[model samples]
Target: MKSLILHTATRLMIGILILFSLFLFFRGHDEPGGGFIGGLVGAGAFTLYAIAFGTDLTRKVLRVDPITLIALGLASLVVSGVIPLITADPFLTGKWLFLEWGNSDIKLSTPLLFDIGVYLCVVGFIVTVIFSLEEEN
Candidate 1:
């Protein structure tokens, strides 16, 4: 049994949740929020959608399999750690690259990549569990 209002509300809420999760992910490096929390929020959004509109539809919306996300996340994390080794730095050392646009400088680091990896890994794990459980029921 599905309520039209629930389905409509879920559609709007999902986008907001995903956007907020991204915000949390990006702000994590400087502030309190981080990949783990962001991923949890993201997974929550999807789970909400799954609950509102069957797991099959949720899976279809995702397009890519959760397994793939998990693999990519692991690979990203490993690569972030390995990149420092190539530059004679210790494993997982914070490596920074500065980009100059106009007068402001933008700093990018391996930790950000690691955070992204963590985010993906968590989201994948949660979604997989949710879908599996939902299917069983």
Candidate 2:
């Protein structure tokens, strides 16, 4: 078992890491960061939590199995690519949808969805591998 200080520190760090990961994921479209980096950071947080607590506890905290996450991510990516085909665009062509708000416009695109899928896929794969390895030992 981890000491009280380690457990407390991990609990605090996990929240910060997850928030930062989301920041990286969202800011990726117009900036340098992207899905892969964001996913890595997020997975790292979970890994730390697993280490401080236990793999079973981490899995319980996550609620969803990593394998499910992988499947969903792959499905999302496939759907994102296929969506443009309905408009007669080539594969993976970006489709944009703009939502008008009171004072600002929110832009959504296929590429963003694709990035989200990539993020999910990476995080799921990494976590699954890590946990499986931990369980084996």
Candidate 3:
């Protein structure tokens, strides 16, 4: 069916979009990009697919429920906040870990985790909104 072909192409494009979003996210720390923008891009992919196909089919392909994704994202953000409290630091305090190997040094931080949480939250939340809008129509 024409719809089926369109759906397939849309899904493929969505996959590409998600990959491109991740590329933007990882490259963000060094340049001028990051999770928030990446998350929006990722969500936009799914939303486009949902529009091309239908919410029911999209949900089946996604496997996980959008509501569950929202909950998980929110929980990740809350857990990240609790980490600082547990360590006796103020909430959301940036914590960093450094690793040195030969001539290379790697830096990791709680802020990164927070950004990841924000990314997930934005993706999940926006996807849910888009899906719900589709359902209403």
TM-score of each: 0.94, 0.96, 0.82
Please list the residue runs of candidate 2 whose C-alpha ends up more than 4 Å from where it truly belongs after superposition: none
List model 1 lDDT by residue over 1-137, tens digit each.
29999899999999999999999998898998999999999999999999999888998988889888899999999999999999898999989998999999787999989998999999999999999989997
- Please provide, for model 2 over 1-137, each residue's C-alpha lDDT reduced to its tens digit, 9 standing for 90 to 100: 56898899998999999999999998898998999999999999999998889899999998999999999999989999999999999999999999999999898999999999999999999999989988998
Number of backbone-clashing residue pairs for each candidate, in the order shown: 0, 0, 0
lDDT, candidate 3, 1-137, per-residue tens? 14877778886798899898898877777787688888899888888778887788778876888778777777777777778887899987877889998999877877677678777878888889988877896
Which number leads on TM-score?
2
- Compared with the true structure, model 3 gives a TM-score of 0.82
Instruction: Report residue 27 deviation for candidate 3 (angstroms).
Output: 2.3
Q: Each model's C-alpha lDDT?
A: 0.92, 0.93, 0.80
On lDDT, the candidate that comes out on top is: 2
**How well does candidate 1 match the true structure in TM-score terms?**
0.94
Q: What ranking of all candidate models by TM-score puts the best one first? A: 2, 1, 3
Ranking by lDDT: 2, 1, 3
The weakest ten consecutive residues by lDDT in model 3 span 1-10
Between candidates 2 and 3, the one scoring higher on TM-score is 2
